[model samples]
Target chain A: MSDDNQHQETFEDFKNSFNYGSRSDLNFKFLKNLSGEDASHFFQELLWKIGDSFNDGDFTRVVDHVNETQAKAYAGVGRFTYDDSPFTPLRAPLSQLRLGLMTSSGHFVAGDDPKPFGVENMSQQEAETRIDDFLKVEPQLSVIPMDTSIEKLRVRHGGYDVRASMADPNVNFPISRLAELQAEGRIGELASDAYSFVGAASQLRLLNHTGPEWVRMFQEKKIDALLLVPV
Target chain B: MEAGGIPTVVIGVHAFRDRLAAMRLPRTVITPHPMGRTLGAPKDDETQKQVILAALDLLETAQKPGKIIDLPGRYRL
Candidate 1:
């Protein structure tokens, strides 16, 4: 069939397609917006796509299109950091901070440290008052382009050194130089501002909670770019 | 990084995209496998660029302040 004669299937064409990638922790409402009949039809087609991975090219094209959209639309993006912190007692690292706040208040960044809100150094009255005020950053973290010579974007999945359950993504030399790039101020040149750990395949529980929070937090922060590097 | 923010693009699998769309979050799908593996080939800049560019398309044509677009099909490199 010609492209025009062929019907274009939408996400709604499926009953329960995989919601397992970026924001896997969402309260899904894909079919809720449509009537029961339409929802049924959506699922019908989705099942067809699943049974036959026949449209790989079409899917790839769409993926390419979305990639372009992300670049042109946002001010900047960053990878959700997944490294095991050198700092001991860093509970969940960046994902923890970002997800905890979102799951808790649905408003705070995933990386916002709530520890200061729970400090015993303050009085009860002071502590209670500081709870809300503490979230707002004094001097918010900002992304500035690194003035170093650059050819391409490279990053390690920062978490490989931390989590045992994860794989060693073992990126090339370019990706491995993330720290050097950051130090040289070259990381801020592209759309994504930071490099995220792309190596954790075993932290599904944490990812299910934290990854979504990162996406939500980035949106709230008005971050336009996102990068994930597997170790 | 300590780097300043830039209009970013993330290439993700369709599953992740659907989840985001369901939750009303905004992001683009690269229709690949799970996270971490962008182009399937490790550190292959050529494949990675193709994948990255796919994610960039969403940023380019996103009309409204908030929108979630289902990318066309699966991605292979």
Candidate 2:
């Protein structure tokens, strides 16, 4: 095949292999808009980074490359930071402490109707299509009971691909694994309710208001330690 | 939540180490997994359970804030 044909074939393979949602379409369009040479370079770099991960069993390089590209694309956007790190020593032994689970994977119980960021009454497709608008609103939290079946869980995040999490909520929200640990006596107990929220929201709101509110709820439950899974 | 007296540990992907560091969380366990599968690959109950245990270990042992531990493993899928 000619070089042009080869690049086109590779791009086609990439499109087929990447099974993300609407945001992926935006990424595809962006790639399509690039000049032929620029597109080839982009794909080459991406493949190289992916290969590096497989070779070294580390993904930091791939992740850094993507982050750098995104940083360049949104150069002026500010990133969130904190000046202080708060620490509360575990007061009880691991086997005796009541554990709480939380995830930013945007998971909720089926039929719970969690309107993340106040985007109410929209299907998953609608929420994804308007994800940019959703990112601007205050973060919302969903409570998933500890014993909720995996079949009753659903995810609605727009930050990254949610398909893996949709297929298996334990990928990001490992409530079942925590319950198993509790059963094995690795922990004293599991909180009756776990918390979740869409992480791709206004961090200011989460840091100042919503996060504290969630903390208060955990406090009310007398949770001794928490396990947070961020997707 | 650590500020509220409820100790917390975060299980995250290694790709976001800088972002996680900037957040200044109390304890963190960074795993060599993809973005969506922070704990492990889908349906891999063994790896998932191991990741959870690692986080729980950090909760019990980490003495200072901003403690980030890298769980040694590659993505299986």
Winner by lDDT: 2
Stretches of candidate 1 off by over 4 Å are A1-188, A191-193, A197-231, B1-8, B65-77
After TM-score superposition, the amount by which residue B47's alpha carbon in candidate 1 deviates from its true location, in angstroms, is 3.0
Worst 10 residues of 1 chain A by lDDT: A99-108
TM-score, per-candidate, Cα-based: 0.31, 0.78
DockQ of each: 0.13, 0.55
Best by DockQ: 2
lDDT (tens digit, per residue) of candidate 2 on A1-231: 468755645554454333333225422333433445655676688899899889888877665555344323322313867777879999879898798888888898888968754556566666656677767877778888999999999888766667888788889999888888889999998889998988878777877888888888888999988888877
Q: Each candidate: RMSD to true structure?
A: 17.6, 7.1
Residue A188 shift from truth in candidate 1, angstroms = 9.9
Cα deviation of B62, candidate 2, in Å? 0.8
TM-score of chain A of each: 0.22, 0.70
lDDT of each: 0.34, 0.77
